[model samples]
Target chain A: MTTDTIVTAAMLAIGDELLSGRTKDKNIGHLADLLTISGIDLKEVRIVADDEEAIVAALNGLRGQYDYVFTSGGIGPTHDDITADAVSRAFGVECIHDPDAMTLLGDMYARRNMDFTEARRRMARMPNGSTHIPNAVSTAPGFVIGNVHVMAGVPQVFQAMLEAVLPTLKTGATVLSRSVQSPFGEGDIGGPLGDVQKAHPQTSIGSYPKFDGTSFSTELVIRARDETILAAAEADVRAMLEGIAASRRT
Target chain B: MTTDTIVTAAMLAIGDELLSGRTKDKNIGHLADLLTISGIDLKEVRIVADDEEAIVAALNGLRGQYDYVFTSGGIGPTHDDITADAVSRAFGVECIHDPDAMTLLGDMYARRNMDFTEARRRMARMPNGSTHIPNAVSTAPGFVIGNVHVMAGVPQVFQAMLEAVLPTLKTGATVLSRSVQSPFGEGDIGGPLGDVQKAHPQTSIGSYPKFDGTSFSTELVIRARDETILAAAEADVRAMLEGIAASRRT
Candidate 1:
């Protein structure tokens, strides 16, 4: 990929708990932040149930569209943890018990004096021809098949797996952003801000409205890959806010 | 919809800020919880950037697949706030400043001694034949056209809009759930849990692993619509855990 080539990614959070509201997702934001800083744009995110068909459909849809697809949840040893099988089906590959994963998990269980039960052995399963993503917190490793990086549903394990996988993927130019806080509300600055955004076509300008009980304020953010372009857009945004502030004085 | 019929829904979270990780989303979980209690199954969730084409595509896709579609964000006055237009395009309708919304916003602005400028007036833009979803926090109303309910991006306002719109929709049977904490880890219980799940095909059983820095434990949740069925499944799960504990003691 070229230097300016945007490395885009999508996230697939697979779990019935998420859709059922039993578990609030922390992975989406965490992954988005990590991917952004790594110079990979997180373009889309889908949260689906633990159903195999849903997981397969979402994985296929995302893996084809983005450079990388990171998935969390549905990788445990339980019956509902079917992400590995779903991913295998998505790629038309056989879901198998890999020897490396089996050995790693067996060793961990032995060290802890555990029985390495069939349920625990279930963690050794992965799609054929996939690489293991070592989990530092728990020894049951996640796997990488095609462009999809499957990780654990547990936050600690998911984060650790991401850390292990991130360094290996190709990245793009890190996007730089500048925030300009407007004392006035979004309604107050929307017109001029739109003009400023149009003037700076290369940059993406977003206007966020904030409510602090008593009144409303706006936070304007300008994002771009080029520092010079970001700075130029920042100046225009600052000037626009100043113009609004001056008019309010009159 | 019939009484026993399941009412399903999908959430579309729109904004560039969300995708950029500049804004961590709180709306998806909030909506999921609300929908769950209302007996509406939140089947899927998709978060996309503030692009018109992307917004239109997501809206159309979600609106077709689910009984109800809720969208939050990008209804502000700025240029990037293109959700209304996107919704209009999704429905193939004209996006216009509704007369009622214009008057409502105009009256509120006048009462607050603020000008209903062109920027603020942008809040009135919605699909031509849509009904307003009132915002108690901010006077700028969201709108509902066809099965799609579009709300503000700000958490406070989005919640307010959801409250207004939720009461007006049809709901299904409330799903009842029971949680049983296991003294053992997920690896210890995964096998028995799988057996329990197989025996009780009506109930959806989920095993969630929890790590508290020192050790891992599991929380097993059983969900179903019938109270008697739920209780039966709960009993089985409890018995399974007790059996595991007895075996460990021996």
Candidate 2:
């Protein structure tokens, strides 16, 4: 894709553990940051349980809306690992044991002198007409069907799979951002920051309040795809903070 | 709700920073764990941007499906902070400055000797017919309208608001969980775990793979509302692990 093209993406994190709060998700933020730097706009994220219907529905919902969909979790050998089947259902394709995946897994298990049991063999299954995403951390590869990239739930495997998948996707304009830390709280600069944001329509400005044990402060962030526009917005935000500081001093 | 009744909930996290990867979300997992213990099933979580249309659409989509909906972020004083307006639009109600919230904020600013500007006043606005969810950490109150509870983005404030809202919620049967640590990897236990899951249909058994730097292990979790079912499932899982260990030793 051209640099100016706007590529969008959504993440679907599938696991009953995530929904049950047994596991706090680390993949969503990791994927979001990677997509942002790769110049893809991450528009939305959904975390659903391992139930096949829920996974299928969420996959269909996100796959249609964004340019790319990345899913983590539910690709293991366990019964609850149903993401591949759900993705196949979403795409109206057959879930099958891919020969390439089977061979890779078989070789790895043979080298380790471990029996490739039926449960371990389950990892070779993927949606038909899908290509495997090689995992450096694990032998069982993730698969990509249509625009959905399915990866493992383990953080290391997920990150390794992403490394393999990211290079293949099309990218858009890289967003640039500038942050201004203000000793003043949001209450002090919110009005002026709002005005600055309106004036610099090219920039998306955000005000985040931070509370230390004793007091509060604000961090103003200005983001844009264009460096010139981003710099302009940053200047305005800094001026706004200075104005507040000066008034307080006087 | 009665003890046996299944009370489900969904969380909507509204912010641009979350999607941009500028900020990692802590509230989703926090809320998920809290709800799980309080007997509320957290079925789904969606993270959307700061845009008004996106917020309203997501809010509407979730509020009808779940018994309770919790939203964090986008209620700050900046221009991009538009969750309050979006929630009002979702409910087709006018967002007005609640007198109680206004007085509360006004008194807070007065006590701190800070100017109560229009931006600070914006925090007092909520949908009509909404009751405030008090924030002990900060004076700006969160609010509850219909089944939706909107709270702050800051972890401290969000937690304080949750403390105030949790007691008012209707709860279901407290789900009890048992986790068995397996020395073997998921590959070894998946088949037997699936069997245990099928036999003990009353419990939901999940296999999660854990990787240290060198090797992989597994954690099997069994959850059920009934203690007897949970115990039975745990026993089966332990037996399965023991069988694997015995076979390997021989």
Candidate 3:
């Protein structure tokens, strides 16, 4: 892995269930953490419905902009599962039944005495010239076409697929962060925080406020690819918080 | 409210915390449900970092494609909270401190014997020609410019702002859905499911699979604006599930 390479990734979460508010998404955060630790920056995320045009457009929009594009959901053996076809359309490639995928799924179903119907056979199809992404939880495999990786939407299956794919890619410098909180409200700390941000332009500072019905508080987090810069920003934030506290006391 | 009108919306979730995986968003689901009930369709959702260019690009991309664009996060009294400025840039407008927002926040702080510091005054800023979306939980108000609505990132404050804004907007016919689950896997029901989908092109049919380590199952959901079409598609799905179950029993 090149140390200078700033690897970036985007996620396409495909499902109507997500848009309908029936299922809360758990994959975005999981994949975000995975990518962050692997030294790949998660740049953007788009959640689209299971529709073909929506999937194709989002796939096309993201795949070219980022180094890697990971998609979760819509690979199941159902009519609504149009991810594979949409991916094929996005890349202008033909989707075919890969022999390896067929063998893995066919044999597994045979062992279970389950009929591998035509709908089940859809699992074996992938964009032409793509490789299979193994699924340990279930025998059905995900596939990678170009830089876009298609994976399951199920939380457990998505995690397993991410693990399977992570090691194969080259990683860069890991982004690190430090968090600090104060009873001081965001308004109380905003001015000094801006000064802190200007002093450390390399680090990104975020202030999140929390209200417990009676009082407001803020948690400030500083992040950077360099540990030294991250630490320096953290120190400045701490000093600012202390200054705010002192003013409140006096 | 027009029954035939198709109301569409896009969401821009602006925060480094979201892209960094430090925060699990709870506002998307809440807004999705709110939009569904209000007869507006949430067509797309984008989670972007706190960076100015990224937010501006996403804001422009989504705001044009959908009828309404709702933004969450970054509207706070903090240095990293750049959402108001970003929105102003997206709309080619000036961001200035609004007297209405200042009065509300100023009085609230005065009641608590807290000084309305410069940092706190930042919360009163909004894009020019915008209207305020009152926040009941916190004194800081969200604002709307053009078709774009900017709200807080905190769950409580975001929800309160949404409630205040929703009632003022025009709504369309509600998109309704019905769901059913079966122990039969998706592959077991896929063929007939396709036929069902073909029979009801106006309604969207989705098939979601579940695995419990021992067996596979599927949940099917059908949705449409017209209740009659939605009900008819649901019947087709239920019959398909029953046929698969009967075959399994025999």
Candidate 4:
């Protein structure tokens, strides 16, 4: 894949539970890893409350900016499960109970001898002109409206839905990263490190510092689509750290 | 505090680690809980990468909209720790090494026989005309420039710095929430729940559903600054669920 062939995606985490500090979102990281591995650069993430206006605004902002916008939560069989409706409003489409979703859910409930209640029927609703994203774990399948892929809030079900959706999407070149840990502290090597970063215009370099009880250490990470440039930048970073550490010893 | 005197805050979590999915953010939830207790509405959250332009844009956007803007991560002694510089640029100020910060770090390092090197001295830097937000976990303090409160990335240090900063800020009436769990599924009671929500427009009602192996249950939460309204809304929600459950039984 060419260096310029980069794909990007954004995520909108829809839940009052997340914003209320009741639920620590595990889906963002999980989705980020999946997107990165599949060569799609995960650009931005926004977490909004379960309010329709908030979800609609966030969805519009993200779907316009990124190739794919994934939404998690608020698609359950409840009053607060308004993600599908909000997404529909964002895309200027009517939310309808898709017949396919109804059949799938109806069959699942019948097999289990469970009541196909009205609330359960709500799960069959999706925005008009959209298609279902299969749910391997749960019968309540998620749907895709425009560029947005609406998925379950439950981690297991979300992961399963993502696995199903990924195969059909277009993927770009893999963005790889290399990390070099330096025994020397960040302050000890910041100048030379910045110089190395300035020299490698194509690669993005990051310095993460940790202060143990006695001393400071740093992990220098370099990311790029091209392995050759990335390796070259990583070498420069390593040399810069070594020179700093050597000068400090003397 | 009057009901009209509600305050709002926004958070910006900076770092490539968070964007790359290498680091799971613990600060957003921590700050959300603190802000909620202090009656500050956390209006929005944005997670941006370690790019200076991204940080500056987010800072400008958030600080302009909210009463308070809090930043987490990227304020360390490293090349990648460019939050202070970005914030300075965002506010059109110079980043300077404050005298108090120099003294604090100098004394701390001196006691431990560690070199107060140039890179280490970088920790003393803050935006011009800014006051240091003391860090109890580490001597390297965070700072506040304009309405933005820049805090450390480490969870322990971030919490300590926030504790130090919160006491100095103006706080509002404590917003409270009451939750009632109903054995009835969301689908069973969504219509009535929506009606109750419309009737109690003052209180924000949320319906969260959980599907156990056998059936679905819902947690209906009502939040408001006024206890009377919140309690009244909670009662309406409870009655709505009870009526639905009773109807289903018959």
lDDT of 3 by residue, A1-250 (tens): 2446788899999998888788889999999888888889999999999888999999999999998999999898778888888999999998888888999999999998989999999988888989888999987899988899999998889999999999998788898888898788787788889999999989888888888978788888888888888999999889888887787689
Error of 3 at B222 (Å): 1.6
Tell me the TM-score of each prediction against the true structure: 0.98, 0.98, 0.97, 0.90
- Ranked by lDDT, the better of candidates 2 and 3 is 2
lDDT of 2 at A197: 86
> Which one wins by DockQ: 2 or 3?
2
Report the lDDT tens digits of candidate 2 across residue range B94-167: 99999999999999999988899998999999999999999899879999999999999999999999999999
Off by over 4 Å in 3: A1-3, B1-3
Question: For model 2, which pairs clash?
Answer: none
lDDT for position A248 in model 3: 68
Q: What is the lDDT of candidate 2?
A: 0.91
DockQ metric, candidate 4: 0.55
Candidate 4 whole-model C-alpha lDDT, 0 to 1: 0.85
Give the per-residue lDDT of model 1 (tens digit) for A70-99: 999988889999988999999999999999
Docking class of 2: high
- Cα-based lDDT at residue A99, candidate 1: 95
TM-score of 2: 0.98
